[model samples]
Target: MDQRQDILAQWAADQIEQLYQHSIPAQMVTVSGDASFRRYFRIIYSENGVHKHWIAVDAPPEHENSRQFVDIANVWSNAGVKVPSVLAFDEAQGFMLLEDFGDVLLHPELTADAADGLYKSSIDSLIELQQIARTDNIPAYDRKLLDCEMALFSDWLCEKHLGLMLSCDEKLMLNQVFETLANSALAQPQVMVHRDYHSRNLMVCKANPPLHDKDFIGIIDFQDAVYGPLTYDLVSLLKDCYIQWPREQVLAWLAYFKAKSAQITDINEDQLVRDFDLMGMQRHLKAAGIFARLSIRDGKHGYLNDVPRTCEYIMQTARIYPEFAAFTEWLESVFLPALNKEKMA
Candidate 1:
C-alpha cells in the first residue's frame, strides 16, 4: 500500500479491534463516492479460516455526523428496506464497519436493455420505502426544510456561483413558483423518502433474495432520508442525475408506480402528476445549485459539466407552467448560456 492507503488501513484495523475486540488482519480497498463529505473502504478479513468482507465508512467527525448514519441505517433496516447491516460503530472516531453489498452501482444497469426489469424492481423498492415513511414513528416532513432547499437555487446558483442577482420581478416570480410547488408537495401523503434515491446509491445484490443475491436491491447513502412527499424519491430515481430515460419510458414507470402505490395507499393520478413535476423541479434546482457549489466551494470542477443538463431539466419543467414564465426565461437567457460556455471551455 502507498502512504495514504497504508495510513487508512492501519487506522481502520486499530478502530475495528477496539470496537469488536476481534483481531483479524484488515485490507482496505478504496470505494467510490459522490459529492459528499463521507468516504468508504472495503475491509476484508479472515477469522477461523473463514473469510469475510465488511464495508468501513470513514466520515471524518468534523465533516459528517456518524451518529446520524447509525440511526438512519437502523431505521431503514428495521423497516424492511435493504440497507447495509451495521456490524459495529464508533461514533467518537466516526468509523463504522458495515456489511459490504459489493461495488456495482445501478447506473450501468439502467443504461442496458435490462433496465426495464431493474427499473420495475427499483420502483418496488421505492414503494417499500414510502410505506416505511408512512408509519407514525417517523417525523412529518415540514415546510421549513422544503423552503430552505428551494432557496439554495437563489442563494448559490443564481448569486454566489453564477455571479448574477435576481431582479425584483424575477425574485417575486421565483417565490411564486416555489409557493405553488411547495403547496402541492405539502398536500401529498407523507412517506419515508430517501432524499438522494437514484441509480448510484442502489446496488444489485443477486446473492440475497428476489432471485440471486442479485435480485436483492441494496440501499446506501441514505443518511438524509426524511418524511416527505410520496413522489420525492420516485422522481429522484426516474429523473436520475447520472442517467436519463426516454419520456415514454419515464411515463410508463410513473404509471406503473401509480398503479402499485394505489394498491397499498391512496393517491390520485392528477395529484401524482403534480407531485412528480413539483418534486422534480425542487430536486433539479437543488442539484444545479449543488453542482455549482461543488465547483466553487469544493473545487471539484468535474461537476460543472453536469450544470447544462440540470439547467435544461429545470427550464423544460418551468416552461410547462405559466406561473414560472419569468424564471424560465431568466434561466434560458442567463444560466443556460453561461453554463454552456463553461462546458465548452
Candidate 2:
C-alpha cells in the first residue's frame, strides 16, 4: 500500500479493535465515495459462521466534520428518521464507524411500480423530521450561503468551465436573477432540511432488521443538515439531480407531500406547490454549478454527464413562470447551445 492507504488501513484496524474487539483482516474493500472529501470502506468479518460488515469512514478533520455527523445522526435517529446509527468515532483521526445499511440504493431500487410506495415512505419520514424541535441550535441556511452558492455558477461553471467571459449587461442580468431566486427562498417557512435528500443518499434496508421503522428507507450523508426553507428538501427529493422523473409523476408526488406536510405545518397547498417549484429551480442552478466545479476542481469528470439534465430542469422551470421568460431566453440562446455543442464534440 502507498503511504496514505497504509495510514488509513492502520486507522481502520485500530477503530475496529477499539469498537468491537475484532481483529482486522486483509479483506478491507473500498466502497464508492460521494462528492465530498470523505472516503468509505467495508470491513468483512465472520460471526456464527455468517459474514457481517461494517462501514468505516475516513473524513479528514481538515476537510470534513465528523462531529457534526455524529451529532446529526443522534438527533435524526432520536427523532424517528431512519438515519445510520453511529457506533464509534475518533475525532482527532477523523475516522468513524457507522451501521451498515447494505448496498441497495433507493435510485436503482426505484421502478415505476415501486416509486409511489417508496416516495410515500420517504415523505412520511420527512414530515416527522421537519417537526423536530430545537432547530434554533442548527446553523441557518442564510442569505450569505445562498449568495455564495449562486455565485459558483458564474465563477466556476460559466467562467472556469464554459469559458464564458460575461459582459457588463450579462453580469447585471445574472445578479438580478440570483436576487429573485434568493428572495423566493427566503419567503418560505423554515424547517429542518436534510440538505442532500436525493435518491443516492437514501438506502433500502432489508425487511428483517433490528429497527423495523428503518426498513422502508435509510438516510445517510446528512452531516450538512441545517434549518432551512421547508420546500428545499422536498424539491431535492422530487427533482433529484442524479435521477429524473416524468413531470406528471413529479406533480403527483408534490401534491402528496403538500397534503402530508400541511398536516404538520401551516403551509397551504397552492403556496407549497409554488414554493416547491421555485425552490427546485434554485437547487438545479446550484447543482449544475456544483457539478461543473466538481469536474474542473476535483477531477471528478463523471458529474459533467449530469450537468445537461440539471440545466434542462432550470430551463423547464423558467418557461413555466412569466417572470422568468427573459431569463429562460438567455439560458436557451446563450448557455444551453454552448453546453450542447461541447457535449456533442
Candidate 3:
C-alpha cells in the first residue's frame, strides 16, 4: 500500500478497535470510488461467531467535508430517507466508520420489468427527503453556483477536453444559452436536492415483492445536497445519464413524481413538467462538463464514456426550443463531430 493508504489503514484499525473491541482483520478491501476524492474500504470480521461488515471512509478533509456528510446523514435519517448511519468519525483526520449497505447498486440490478416499482420506491424516498420543510440553513443553489456549473461546459469539456478555441460569436451564443438555462432553473420552487440522486448512488436493499416495506433503496453520496429546484432530483432519477429510458417511460415517471410532489407542495403539475424538461437540460450540460473534468483533470477516463449520452440529453432538449436553436446546431455541427474524431483517433 502507499503512504496515504497506510495512514488511513492505521486510523481505520484504531477506530475498529474502539468500536469492536478488537483490531480489524489484516484484509481490508477497497470499494469502488466515484468522481469525488473520497475512498471507501469494506471490513469484514467475525463478531461472536457472526460475520459482520462495516464501511470505513477516507474523505481527506482538504478535499471533502466529513462533518457535512455526518450532519446530512442525520438530517436524511430524521427526514425518513434511509442513509448509511455514521458509526464513528474523526473530522480533523477525515475518517469515518459507517454502516455497510452491501454491494447492490440500483444501476446494475434494474431491469425493464422491475424498474417501475423500484423507481416508485425511489420517488417516495425522494419526496420524503424534499418535504423536510425547514431547510433554510442549507446552502442555496443560487444563481452564482448555477452559472459556475454551466461554465464548466466551456471551461472543461470544450476547451480542456476538445481543445476548442471558440470564436467570439460562438462564445456569445453559448453564454446566452447558459443564461437561459440558468433562468429556467431559478424559476422553479426550491427544495432539498440530493445533487447526485442517480441510480449509482442508490443501494437496493431487497429485490423482492416487499421492496417498499422498509427503505427500498439506501441513499448515499449526499454530502452535496442543496436547496434547489423541486424537479432537480426527479430529473436526476428519471433522466439518469448512465441509464437511458424511453421518452414515454420517462414522461410516465415524471407524471408520477409530479402527482406525488403536488400532494405535499403547491405545484402546478402541468407547468412543473416544463420545469422538469428545462431543468434536465441544465443538469445534462453540467454532467457532461463534470465527466469531462473528471477525465481531463482527475485522470479518471472511464467517466468520459458517459459524456456522449449526457450530450444527447442536451441535444434532445435543445432541439425542442427555438431559443436554443443556435446552441443546439453548434453542439451538433461542431461539438459532436470533434468529440467523435477524438474518440476515433
- The candidate that achieves the highest lDDT relative to the unseen native structure: 3
- Sorted by lDDT (best first), the order is 3, 2, 1
**Model 2 residue 13 lDDT score:** 74
lDDT of 3 by residue, 113-213 (tens): 89999999899889888887645447999999998898888889998899999999999998898888789888887788898999999998743322235
Model 3, runs deviating above 4 Å: 134-137, 207-215, 263-266
Model 2 stretches astray by more than 4 angstroms: 18-21, 24-26, 135-137, 262-265
**Tens-digit lDDT string for candidate 2 (34-62):** 89999888878887796668888888899
**Clash number for model 1?**
10
lDDT tens digits, residues 1-345, model 1? 655456556767886677667676657877865688677889876778956567887777888877777888887788788888887777776777788888788887765678988889999988887776454444566787788888888888888876677788778878887888788888877778889989889998758543234457788988777788878888889887667777678878999998888432466676677678778998888888888889889988787677667766777778877877777887778777766665676
Candidate 2, lDDT over the whole model:
0.83
Better of 1 and 2 by TM-score: 2
